[model samples]
Target: TTGNISFRNETTFGGSGTVTYRWLVNNVQVATSTDLNYNFTVPTGATMPYMFTVKLEASNIVGCKTVQEKTVQFNPFPRALFNVVQARGCAPFNLQIGNQSTNADQYEWYLDGTLVSTLHSPNNIVLNDFDRTYTLRLLVKNQYGCIQDEQSVQVSTYPYLKAEFDVANDLSCNGILDVQITNRSVGATTYTWDYGDGSPVYVGNNPSHSYGRQGVFTLKLTASNGFCSDIFTKTVSVSNTPSASFTSNVRSGCNQLIVRFRNTSINATEYLWDFGDGAFSREENPEHQYAFANTAFTVKLTVVNQYGCRDEVSATNFIAVSPPPQANIEVAPARVIKVPNYSFTFKAVTTDDIILYRWDFGDGTSSDRSEVTHKYDRFGTYKVKLFITNRNNCTSVIEEEVI
Candidate 1:
């Protein structure tokens, strides 16, 4: 902040007024400006623990002058960086991490997720980046006695087999079931995923499987690079039916929209929401606004149980944030859409010089014009949605069918 800090001062000539200006870097005799204003420039490379002093000297007469000083500082202790993952050689959290520059000696390591580095260390600790979380504290000696600097490595959770059992790894889902596991963890090999059925596959970490019948089963996975095993589980309640429900939308005052969920979960405390705004909401209940009118949005939710297992649910008509009357929505056939495949258009009713139009077709594919033309991508039926709006700022939906 050394550039130019401009300000004006007024003094009632008590015995003739006069003001002198002086600029000093680190309190050294730098310069003296004749005018009331000055352009001050402090030398760069002055990092933490450094100061810039600017003083204004005012004299009221014979050797009677008062001085006022202001000090400024830049670049306080470098910000903390944290990122830990399951994979080896993975980058630090957000890749902003680097070697500590605070010149320290003692280092401590902690596990089990974040902060709370319970164990203290006095040596250069070689970290195991495969765990859930790893944070370190470096005890450096300076003017500040044994200062501690910390960094974290978020080990990637990418799975080696693509699919992991949430209950028993060595478990089953019964009947015809497909399992989807995420691959973000780092450093893993040879995933032995068991569907607890008649057969198991030896492939990637997240793979789909099927069972011959419905009953109590165990799921398991043995992954290794010949060094150690990283296992994860779930209990199968395999019946003839799978039940779950998506959350409903809430309307708040001041045109605010609050959305929440009531799931059909056996056990869960975590959830992920895709509000369809290109922006995602992250709680069981989230609030948003409809600043823009006539918008349409698609929302998705996934819940995780205490067993470290997660699943996502997608419904065709989950959310609806549309644009500001860019297009109109309309349904065709006016009744039912036949299974298999069909196509249709969404039209706007009023003129108001309607500039544009968009159609959600509701079957997953939408038309992007004032009058859209679309068809069903797969067999079966859909609630084909057509949203319509006029240039004058009015919105409405027309639902129909294509059998």
Candidate 2:
């Protein structure tokens, strides 16, 4: 490195003709000229100050002379260097600059070609834009008001985050309320979930959860990437559980009853019926056959909804079936009776459970008795029919000929 120095002579010589000048540094003469001002260059020492004694002598053609002496010193040029704490970070980023300049007495800081600070070290610098880059420059000067060196660095900002999540509006199925969460955030590295069903908070990208009961609930998710955070919220719902109920067209009958069942289930998607006679059906509404007689049956219904919730109902002794009575007719006289003896007795020898009876003599006369005797006016043969009914409204008939 090198520096410049200048010397001036302010001397007066009387009676002078063609005055000459002599310039010397450290007692060594360097130039002998008539010039009053002299400019010189010298090497800058390593981390040390350099001092020189400058002398000037003036003489004319006469034997008259004048001399002046001065001491000069040269300081080293300043070198500017700095480092940025963070080159790139998320939005609203704080910037830190470390000043590593040498031999500087004054400092000037510039951001994006604009002077921001003149102190040796600036403080509290922050950048608030996303996906942008900025330039920072440092200018340093020595005590001589000489700005000789400059340093610059770049600071960049990362993109901001937009947090979002997606889930089904209705999470009910078969009866159970299960939810699936999807993270749809941009520029996020972590996630949090609040199911709002009095459950524990969840952490991760996507998760599966089940609610203890069915109703409406609030859902929330938060996404973060160490620079920014975002939140999403939604209202979700769950359906009710299934209830089982049923009805029948006829609850009781006799002799191979065929019953038609009607389903009245609520919030159900599937149904099962147990006829209690070793028969089952999976239809919503089913008709079952009861081929056995004199039997009482217990029916059951089971229902399930889309969320897999189930319910069941049982009807104890829901149906009753009875056997028909056996009908028989008997006459005191033989089947072949003589003319004018056309009187006969009819009897209901049916099952003892009989409740009522009917007799048709085939001669335009009738009787409503368990046993009856009737007479024919003509000598022709006649048919006598006997009908019997039991407690369960079951009927049977028998016929006999009389002459």
Return the top candidate by lDDT: 2
Give candidate 2 misplaced runs (Cα > 4 Å). 1-202, 205-239
Error in Å for residue 221 of model 1? 15
Tens-place lDDT digits, model 1, residues 207-291: 6565556565555665665555566555453433332346565422112344555555444567777766676665666655545
User: Model 1: runs farther than 4 Å from truth?
Assistant: 1-13, 17-47, 60-64, 75-77, 81-154, 157-403
Writing each residue's lDDT as its tens digit, candidate 2 over 1-403 gives 4545555556677764788888888898888854434454565444434667888988878868888888877666799998987788777777777888988988888888888888777775677788899998888888865547998889888887877877764556344567776778898898888889888998898887887667678888888887667788877667676779999999998888899999999889999899999999999999988988888999999998765568899999999988778877778767777767466777777545888888888888899998877777788778888888888898877888877
Poorest 10 consecutive residues by lDDT, candidate 1: 89-98
TM-score, every prediction: 0.25, 0.45
